[model samples]
Target: MEILPADLQLYLETHCDIEPEALKKINRDTYLKILKPHMLSGHYQGRLLSMLSKMMAPSRILEVGTFTGYATICLAEGLTETGFIDTIEINAELEELLNQHFKSTNVEKKIRLHIGPAAQIIAGFDGPPLDLVFIDADKKNNLLYFALVLEKVRPGGLIIIDNVLWKGKVYGDAQDTDTKLIRELNDSIAANPQVEKLILPVRDGLLLIRKK
Candidate 1:
């Protein structure tokens, strides 16, 4: 379920700021080598992440999934001078590739890659108060991740969850486990009094939650 037609998507990309050269290479390499290349947030979504980060101007960012480190870089673009991003990726196989990609960018030092289950790592995260979080990891654990990170987010901080639309499966009969979990998380967030939320029909979908 493409919210925008291919032609329109391309047109928007053309008009937006050009993607960083390093990101462009990573996008190409991801499609060529990764099993689920679509998981990588490409041009439009990457720029969206960057734009949101810039708007927030967060001092600390947490990324639950670092697939190819594309979105990680995008989010880090708006970090304050002394800020850093702690990104967790479950697949150990991607560690080397992720590091290699990071090394090619100036933001390398600002990104700390943690290769392991995000749940466990997040459970022990005692870093600086988080000003922004990007949750794009396991769908089944979306609720748990939101709970774990909510308190850590400074009041008025943002938590952006990707794939909430789950390719529009969230709208129709969602028999799959992942889709069901996403819907549950969406509903729970909507009803929760702790945060302000909105769903954006970006790439797959992005649920933005601002901690109150």
Candidate 2:
């Protein structure tokens, strides 16, 4: 899953801005309390998300997958004074742990946690046009999630999809279902004239698309 060499990854982490205390706790707690800790965005990618969120200064943000809320906290850091984030997670068991961390950091106020089927929940999603959206949920539904959020995003808004590379499995023939979907999503984004896209080899892979 790590595309970068250990030394280089360490160097990159070492050179980046110090990880915030709140995010540090999320990073630590997720590893300790959660079942697939690797799924949490971790320090490097968390910082990347935070950087992008701050740069965008989005008024409204939508996070399609909220695993232990690591990225949720990171993204919330960059919200405008009145900005808010709606983060959805499929696992109901994580609701308490997520809220606990959010409350501990006071980010709970800026985040609205929704627990249930992401697609169904997204179907009812309504608010100001989203200025930023991060989709890191079910791999198979990547296309569906993209379609659901595309029109809701403001022009020039960003949609960042994680794991686009699928551990390099997307490079050639997609032998599995998830790989095929991710590959298809990548191709679909590349072909779409409605958005400008780039795939940053950060962590697994981050496919960044901006609505045109």
- Write model 2 residue lDDT over 76-111, tens digit each, in one string: 999999999999999999888988888878667999
Cα distance off (Å), candidate 2, residue 111: 0.3
lDDT of 1 by residue, 82-194 (tens): 88999999999999999999998989999999999888998898967899999998888999999999988999999999999987899999688888888899999999999
lDDT of 1: 0.92
Worst lDDT 10-window in candidate 2 = 1-10
- For model 1 the TM-score comes to 0.96
**Which parts of model 1 are misplaced by more than 4 Å?**
1-4
Clashing pairs in 2: none
TM-score of each: 0.96, 0.96
Report the Cα lDDT for residue 148, model 2: 96
Q: lDDT for every model?
A: 0.92, 0.91
For candidate 2, give the lDDT of residue 40: 83
